[model samples]
Target: MEERVPVPPPHPAQDVTEHVGYRLKRAAAALRGAMDRALREHDLTVPQYSCLELLDEQPGLSNAALARGTFVTRQSANVVLRGLEDAGLIVRAAHAEHGRALPVHLTPAGRQRLHAARGAVYAIETRMIEAVPAERLPALLADLDTMAAALDA
Candidate 1:
């Protein structure tokens, strides 16, 4: 069995900006800003792009499932879906086939839009990842997962 390295105890930060949470939030905001700018050319907000991406990958996902995947509230997901439907990018069944879940699927137009937007989104990720050493990426991803799991616990 591989031995686990013991994690060090938390240390006090000299300032709020030095805190891990603050740094994470700062990074998230930066990423969001970049995505917002890139996605605007495709006429998509970050949440709309997120929902479309999820729907493309998993057709017939319910609103609640989409909300969870997109990290938005169910109410917000409904609004997003309504907008997509209005734009003819997606379609929801007129009535739920099972329970109260109205399954959402991307239209042909949605698929096209997602494909167009994916390039811009991926380019932003490439730029961000390039800033980090290639060899350290695996560890960085693992550390992020660990931090999220710790808070969720």
Candidate 2:
């Protein structure tokens, strides 16, 4: 009679941690926590900071656009917008030229705050990117986008 070999359990990371959804959620949580801590000194929450960043990149974004960019609901974006407006960090046109979509733009204060917050956020990004092989950075970014797009579809 021949002896039989037993199969070993799959690697936990591959089976669970390495799952696309799990890794995505884990990565998002880690980044969110890091950003939350880093932005705290500036008195900015993650969503608020995101709005500033997006406005800097694409000025005149509507509430809907900013909400989509920041991955928040339109109502939530409105609340953030109100807070920023009260802080004098951004300005929204009183009337929407096209419809109810008020264009949002960052004020000088917003620019300065974003400039300061960027350094801290960039450091976090550098740490994450460095953990992966430098040459694979581009492919990794593309892969991440592809995964996100796959879900969008």
Quote model 2's TM-score: 0.88
lDDT by residue (1-153, candidate 2, tens digit) is: 989896665444546667667778999899999999999988899899999999999999999999999999999999999999999999999999897899999999999999999999999999988899999999999998997798898
Model 2, C-alpha of 119: deviation from truth (Å): 0.5
CA lDDT, candidate 1, residue 24: 95
- State in Å the error of residue 9, model 1: 10
For model 1 the local lDDT of residue 87 reads 94
Query: What 10-residue stretch in candidate 1 is worst by lDDT?
Result: 6-15
- Residue ranges of candidate 1 with Cα displaced over 4 Å: 1-9
Clashing pairs in model 1? none
Q: Judge candidate 1 against the unseen true structure and give its global Cα lDDT, from 0 to 1.
A: 0.94
lDDT of each: 0.94, 0.92
Tell me the deviation in Å of residue 137 in model 2: 0.9
- In Å, residue 115's CA in model 1 sits off its true spot by 0.4
lDDT score for residue 103 of model 2: 95
Residue range with the least summed lDDT across 10 consecutive positions in model 2: 6-15
Could you give candidate 1's per-residue lDDT for residues 24-88 as a string of tens digits? 99999999999999999999999999999999889999999999999999999999999999999
